[model samples]
Target: MSYKLIPPGKRRNRHYWLRGTIAGERVEVSTGCETRQAAQAWAADYVARLEGQRVPGIGEVVAFERAAELYKAAHPHLSKSDIRLVGAVAKYFRNKGKACHEVVHADLVAAADELKPGRAASTKNRKVIGPAAAVLHYAANNQWCTYQRIEKFWVSRKSNREPARDEDLAVLIANVEAPPRRKKFGRKADYNVAFKRLLLLMLYELGLRIGHLLTVRWDDVDLRAARLKVRIPKSDEIASLELSPVIVSELANLTSATGVNRPALGRGVDRRGRLFPWTTNRGVHAWLKPLTDRLGIKYTPHMSRHKLATDAQVLPDKKAAELGVWKDPRSLHRYQHVRPEAIPGRSAATLLALPAPDKRKAS
Candidate 1:
């Protein structure tokens, strides 16, 4: 009862005005309604919000679009892909005038279907359902609505894709290092080939996501210490890692070849110079595709990351997670696709070699 609505008068516009104290602050604003009753309701909700009280029927009053906007503003660290998905979801719900609390499981499922038609379930989950749920959960946290539990579409695991093999990568590297058959190209070609070889080596050896690898700057590496730091794109974390002797040698050679001397410690130099020429993940994939096709292998840059995770499974989960820059150790399950034969003491031959148990013992 601390708030009151004032009817339109000579000094005020046609819309009703609200004047009162809310949360110990004096407030005066147009209610955007001509009737006193409507203005009174608006003032009540506004006061409730400022007083930290749950607004009555808030789910029906607040739109999903508004909730999504607040969610985006609250999470500025969201990746570009996630931001785009949230924007798309907001646009879809904007025209519908869908209320944040009114959003249900079916609505998100339908949105996914419409927004990503004919796309894989994983695509729909990542691009539509995930963002929609995020908006709703954020709204719920602020007492704007109840939390929504959305069930994601089931994705099939029948893909034949396996992690990249060392031998296959070696073959690809050799192909890049080999001199061109035509003599039209001079010694300059050697330098270009050397650059490509280093790129391939780092992609597999470091086991970094293609996006993370491309963003690596010259300042992030230390040739003298055989160490480097990579900022994980997904979690926005810095991971300091030790480099192998082979990688260290390749990096030194590439640095000498580029003729760009590393700046002295404590010197102010431009740290924005990227190590690789490719900027986008698509660019790296497009460049590697033809080379992979010629070698009759289905290897991709992501497969190299999987290979690293799988090989690193030999270490403790915490250590493995550190090597891959995964914030959660459980995330290792998604990247690891260990071959059955590669498991110690659990090979097919070892299982078959075991003597059969006697039926008399059981009786």
Candidate 2:
């Protein structure tokens, strides 16, 4: 086992960073000491423990909080939301600072239970158990503790959002209030209402997550090419989607009316600005809720996504998955919701009611 002292960069902290390696597994930690000798001593002890060397009371054990930091450092490619969720789980155990070996199956179960109230099972699992399992798995891999307990936690649920029906969508569109367009001497007014309508239309037409949609910039749209550059927030990947004629037309009008020239709309589009600047995701939802409620439609931005996914069932599974940016085709199953009104009232038993002619056929 050996240790290396790494100098800090970007972060203007005075303390030196220490990296320890043992049996091909390396862990980098902050020594919290300025002197090289003290840092080296700390790394030596950490390496020895990770190597399964017992020193009296201190054995192969890492605090959950520290382990979380280590895990985060190890996975730099995790998305912003993913990092936040992991941090939330880590912060939950900050006060306790429980050691890896000290964590029991019941503790995880209790955590899951705590998250279960008022939250969807899927949400609870994804936010709580998932991160907890990851932390525990990291601990197990480092020989800090065994991971047999992770198997005990299992959380899943049917998807909450359902596809919006065509009729319902029509109602929503009809209910959408158009923004007041005041063209005084060819000057444009605030396009907030028009933008909201177009945003809803795009969300329905193209199955995009609201988070991804809201971050779209002018640079991301290609009007002449009829393509849109979409950034997937979960995977941090850029995907291209072909624009429909209606969408293309609307976008062209929007750009012309509000493009970087008008005083009202040109406030922020200096270099690279958002197409619809709402500031927060909550603001997007707040703008949407009134129209949906007025229409009496059980709808959300995600429901619009489901609507598009359901409509894309005619496409091949792979094609559908690709369009929806789903990593696995099975993930598409959750979005395959048929409108309740579309279901035929006649059951198979009723539809295939044949006469009892078979009884006389033998004769």
Residue 38 shift from truth in candidate 1, angstroms: 23
Clashing pairs in 1: none
Would you give me the overall lDDT of model 2?
Answer: 0.66
Q: Which candidate ranks first by TM-score, i.e. highest? A: 1
Point out the worst 10-residue segment of candidate 2 by lDDT: 342-351
lDDT of each: 0.70, 0.66
lDDT of 1 by residue, 35-144 (tens): 87888788777876776442324434577877787788778888788888999999999977798877889889889989899998999988998899888888888778
In model 2, what lDDT does residue 217 have?
83
Models 1 onward score TM values of 0.72, 0.65
Number of clashing residue pairs, candidate 2: 0
Worst 10 residues of 1 by lDDT: 340-349
